[model samples]
Target chain A: MSRINDVGGMEGFGAVPVDNAEQPAFAADWEARVFALNSALLRRGVYNLDEFRDAVERMPPAEYLDASYYERWFAAITTLLDERGVLPRADLDG
Target chain B: MSADHGDGALAARVRRAETLLEERGVVDGAELDAILDRYLATGSPANGARVVARAWTDAGFRDRLLADANAAVTELGFRAGGLQPTLLRAVANTAEVHNVVVCTLCSCYPIALLGPSPSWYKSEAYRSRVVRDPRSVLAEFGLTLPDTVRVEVWDASAETRYLVVPRRPDGTDHLDDDKLAALVTRNGLIGTAAV
Candidate 1:
């Protein structure tokens, strides 16, 4: 429930697992697109970095941990745009 | 306000938002795609390896890199823009100390330098464990440091990013920059391993 993003030195997390296999940066085209879109919008001043980060951090702990890396980005972008009233929910639905 | 929607649904929403931005003239679709292609291409750890290799060979440049990382990297013609420019710090590992970078908050990484952050680096386990038990985390990465070496964890934030300058491996003095760069791995730059 805490909005704090700094989790360094916290306890109760499990053992760390390492995946050393080499892989492409993005798993698919959509990931690349999302990556570009997020940076593009950020550069264009659609939203500041902290606000976008806040949107990501505001996620419920369970959801944050369960979601994939880009999933979190998508969630943040959606929430930020919604909060800004730039992209309405109806547009997202339809 | 989160959905369990699969990647398909998430991709659809991402596309919709992308189209919305284009339609509003905030960003051009073609330009964004082209930029994205270039961005992804530039994300390999090789870029970081090159920086580390240069640092290992040139002490003067290493000092400059440690003092002013962004400027030093720009001197080598590597710069990142778009998504607010933040301060980047380069922490060098010596015989006595080792450093590891993590974003306990949310994978705040130097994507511009090391390319995309690895999936494991973003996992909650890594964020949660690296800070608490860095030695074990390093061991998991196949890097077993001696007890004499101190482990320092750098937590990345919204305003600052960190890059680890791994110690040059033994018997590498004869190798050229390209060869040394070839030896540098992404994990090495992340302090999970040594170059």
Candidate 2:
């Protein structure tokens, strides 16, 4: 199992005690639609990106299986977006 | 502290919204959920298995599906109507070559059979690369359809959708429905591999 440094995401997740936001360390295409969705989830507090990040930090190398992991991430983010007014209630709760 | 992380509740919410729109004749909720959940759990749709099975069993049905997948599929029993309707045509694979589907515009997948799209399919990299050079892309996924194999790429824009009608693998003729279904993996539909 690789440590947080080996996998290369712990620092990016508001973990690893980042010294600056300017040099944002992120995974590929974080500015894309889905990543935006994840950030929105965290900002809106629908779920805990912090906790999720913590989980990621602790995860072994093999846990990042197919799209399911990413799907779960998207689900968490979308749930928050729906909870907030940014996305309509019907668009989420319907 | 929260109630969303437990299942695919977030995606369910998105699907729920789509369903409401569908109710007002904007989209098809049944079709949307059937498509979405396939990706949520199985990474593919059950209809993929159904299509593959039928293609192997009946030549006439195979011909019909290849000509017009939506119509032939409807004959077998699956809803094929909606507001922004999609017409699914099949691309058959032969010994000489194979066919694969990718929506260059977006990930316009066959929602009728395959539910929601996995993250990889929707990525700009996959959408852009699959059409221009499928052999290289498929190779990255550990699949290489031979040069002899005619690699016809269907551009699945928002207008028309497509699905890969994978050839039945050898030693599968005697297998029953369940066994055959098990063989139809998501990668096979993407023309990345055979079961």
Candidate 3:
């Protein structure tokens, strides 16, 4: 069989990693649930449609970080959602 | 049902209050403090642990998960994205190795499923580092690889959402769903740890 367990005695184990804090809160359950929710929309084609994808592909890789860069993406996707009828502009802007 | 309506009204009031707070330049920071003091007395969905758990259990479901975790979740109840709910995706960690998840543009989390995110998750440290050298960052988390596993990085933006589902641990096949879920920590769920 393919090698399963690892040096950590965590063989056959699959995961991200652990926290480095004095208190390993291990308290991100709700975070996972909500995260799953948003991605599900994208995978199903409910969030970013073709236009948004094209806009992102065309936009520069954003060599520098700026609030405007964030705004640009938001605008692109919001515009796409309005155009595709997934979300009415009012839902976003208002 | 009355209690449900009451909760809805409370949430609406919170949103209305937050909007007014924003207009006043208060932002989500102060509001979060208040939310913590008041509403989160028991617990809430911002943590992102349980959401990761669901992502680990099933495979056909995992495919559905990465494809569109929201509808999969919405079929149950929670909703997110602006005033209403939207989809949240979770990536799976398999046998051969590394994965890093982040929303490079904005903080699009699986809020309905997970709870408040770790402060680091929302910072430039995670957003910048993961894309640059995922292996190094994973190493910082004590996740060393043997060069056989391929690392996959996913950038979540306001446009898309994602969480990482850690691989199930060894020798725990005997653990049932709930037990298995118990080991699915927040960091593990976020691709920071193996289950």
Pick by TM-score: which candidate is best?
A: 1
For B31-69, candidate 2 gives per-residue lDDT tens digits of 444433343443236667777787888889888888878
Model 3 DockQ class: incorrect
lDDT of each: 0.82, 0.56, 0.51
Rate residue B24 of model 1 by lDDT.
78
DockQ of 3: 0.05
Runs in model 3 with CA error above 4 Å?
A1-94, B1-60, B80-86
Local error of candidate 3 at B143, Å? Answer: 1.5
Give residue B120's error in model 1 in angstroms: 0.9
Model 3 lDDT, residue A15, Cα: 35
Interface C-alpha root-mean-square deviation, candidates in order: 2.7, 14.9, 15.1
DockQ (Cα-based) per candidate?
Answer: 0.60, 0.05, 0.05
Whole-structure CA lDDT of model 2: 0.56
Candidate 3, B1-195: lDDT as tens digits: 122334344334334433543454424344444433432332333334444555556666667767777656554454545323444666777778556666654355654455555555654456656766678777877778778899887776555667677776788767666666777665665676665
In lDDT terms, which candidate is top? 1
Which candidate has the top score in DockQ? 1
Worst 10 residues of 1 chain B by lDDT: B1-10
What tens-digit string does per-residue lDDT give for candidate 1 at A4-91? 4456666766767578888788886777887787877787788988888888888887777677777778878878877788777777
Per-residue lDDT tens digits of candidate 2, residues A1-94? 5542132112222111212112211233222334444433343354564454444334433332223334445444444444454455555553
Which docking band does candidate 2 fall into?
incorrect
- Error (Å) of candidate 3 at residue B32 is 9.6
